[model samples]
Target: MSGHDLPRLGSLAWEPALDRPDLLAAPVLAALTAWAEQDERVRTQVAVAPIDPDHADTATLNAVHGLPTEASANCVVVAGRRGDDERVAAVVVRATTRADVNTRVRRLLDVRKASFLAHERAVAESGMEHGGITPLGVPAGWRVLADARVAEPGTLALIGSGVRRSKLLLPGDLLAAAPGVEVVEDLATAIDA
Candidate 1:
């Protein structure tokens, strides 16, 4: 479905991402623009919304914007090291789940240990705000691992547009097919109630 088909939210105006470069990071804008050019679905389906920086966290964003928690996704940067070599990846999962960094991610990365990247490093390296690092514009060579649940067709993931002052909304399937994204089974485990 296209953005025009979706209901409008209060105050948060939805617009084509390609039309608002100021709301996105350089790399993210480049990638999304390229994808929109190459795929008609992307051009019509992707949307962006300006948000209050203070309410950028998933729960707060959802509550204030009337978006559902299940429709949100979180992208976390993880680092793994073996000897002198270090590998970093962006792990994307539903807001209802947490990345399985200790076991699955560590094993997949083939590193001795896997841990969340330092907050400062993640923000600086990604060229994004501390709470707004996303898989779309992460530094090159960093893997993007998305949990299977992130690809469900009807679900729209409200993800960072590389900044805390705005957010991107797109179908999960589109995110799964984004450049460098790898949809992995059981990449995240469900959170306890």
Candidate 2:
């Protein structure tokens, strides 16, 4: 949506993300600026909203903002080993679905097993807060895998801005088209929620 057309959810007062670097963590701001340099649409399409860090989780964030579950995506860090080398990646899936970590991610990483990265390692390595890791600005070598469902037309998903105090709203197609993202089918399976 355009800047003026930004959706008004329950309690969030949306502002252009570029207008509030303070709301974004260092890495997130850097990534956003870089992306905007390459894609002008990024400047208008992305937005941010300040929030209580306590409401950072998807369920709580949606509840407080009157956002539907489908309006957000969750980013998870996964790591697996192949021989002596370790591979790391971030997976973005709709909040209504869970990543097929064991079947899909493991196969994609070419590892015997894949598991969630340690909380300490994820936060430290990503330069982001514990509950606010987005697929944007992950380490260069780390792959970003987004489930196809998240990138369908007309989807705008709320994502962390590398901090719990704010969030970024971005179109799913833009996320799929991001420089390092790989759009994969069946990467996640729907859950009861």
Candidate 3:
């Protein structure tokens, strides 16, 4: 994508707070922030904001919390063995839609079958509390997959802070900050609300 094609998040309507806690300051956010800072191309287009922890879900999280849904999106990381194989991979899917792990993801990851990582294992492996896991700060040796839709220029994404007390609004460029994230075109299939 051309530099001009990149969406400058400042154009979007988002609020910033001087007193608000830094969502990226947490382990997850810190890791991601460091990564962005290390890359000039990514640092230029990235931004972060704090949100209420209760607003974790995309549907009601924004309404009661009084935030812009357009600026918030969900992040889900799934890890498990294939159908009958022992291979394990982490799949990241957006909250606006569910990951088609049962079909699309399993095939894309080239695993026999896949399932959500157990609560204990997820938190343990990610070193993040449940409800606060972001693609950032994940331990080394794990695979990262992002929804292609997230790659759309100017898109803002809601990610966890490694803690359940807050969230961060980061530029979509974060999708590129990770080491091995693949933007899958059909990773997420819409579900009936």
Candidate 4:
């Protein structure tokens, strides 16, 4: 599909992700392929577009793409341990907010403490780039917690496509309803943009 057929978001030239698997990281491609067959929204609405890897950071991306920071979502990896077992979760929040890792995340994981996963470990475990880990293809054992604000009506989530070279854009409800996603209230605290 060409840019004309893709969902319009920001100023990027969007294209159908399934038609340009090269724009997606391996796990992301696989997840999309599967979800397309299982969910109508995934097949019809998800779109991808190339981006400058150097500008993949949320602030830079929003600035370059002419999107409000609230239109973008950030995914972060967190890990906590209880005894010898560890629980890992991918928390998604609007770019203007921060995940409550110290209390909410730790409580959600039922562990005494939760911390952001090391960049290297996150990249290695998720099989995605350091700045482009997304909730869509995170390991099945890990939880995906999207802050409720992200699923509010009229929001479009600009998220990593598991690679720094491209981004995925879709309605927030699509992400909220994606398989294994849990919408949690007050999961993140808003920060000034």
Candidate 3 TM-score versus the reference:
0.74
Candidate 2, pairs of clashing residues = none
Q: Per-model C-alpha lDDT, please?
A: 0.86, 0.89, 0.60, 0.89
lDDT of 4: 0.89
Q: 1 or 2: which has the higher lDDT?
A: 2
lDDT of 3: 0.60
Alpha-carbon RMSD, candidate 3: 4.5
User: Best to worst by TM-score, what's the order?
Assistant: 2, 4, 1, 3
Candidates in order: C-alpha RMSD to true structure: 1.8, 1.4, 4.5, 2.6
Q: What are the per-residue Cα lDDT tens digits for candidate 1 across 44-100?
A: 677788899999998988889788888889999999988998999999999999999
lDDT of 2: 0.89
Error of 4 at 190 (Å): 0.9
- What C-alpha lDDT, on a 0 to 100 scale, does residue 166 get in candidate 3? 61
| Model 2 lDDT tens row, 1-193 | 6545554455798887888999998888888899889887777788899999999999999998898889789999999999999999999999999999999999999999999999999999999999999998898879999999989868887889999999888778877877789999999999974
Residue-wise C-alpha lDDT for candidate 4, range 1-193, written one tens digit per residue: 3214346678898877888899999999998888888876676678899999999999898888898888889999999999999999999999889999998889999999899999999999999998899999899999999999988866788899999999998888888988889999999998965
For model 1, what is the alpha-carbon lDDT of residue 162?
Answer: 92
Lowest summed lDDT window (length 10), candidate 1: 2-11
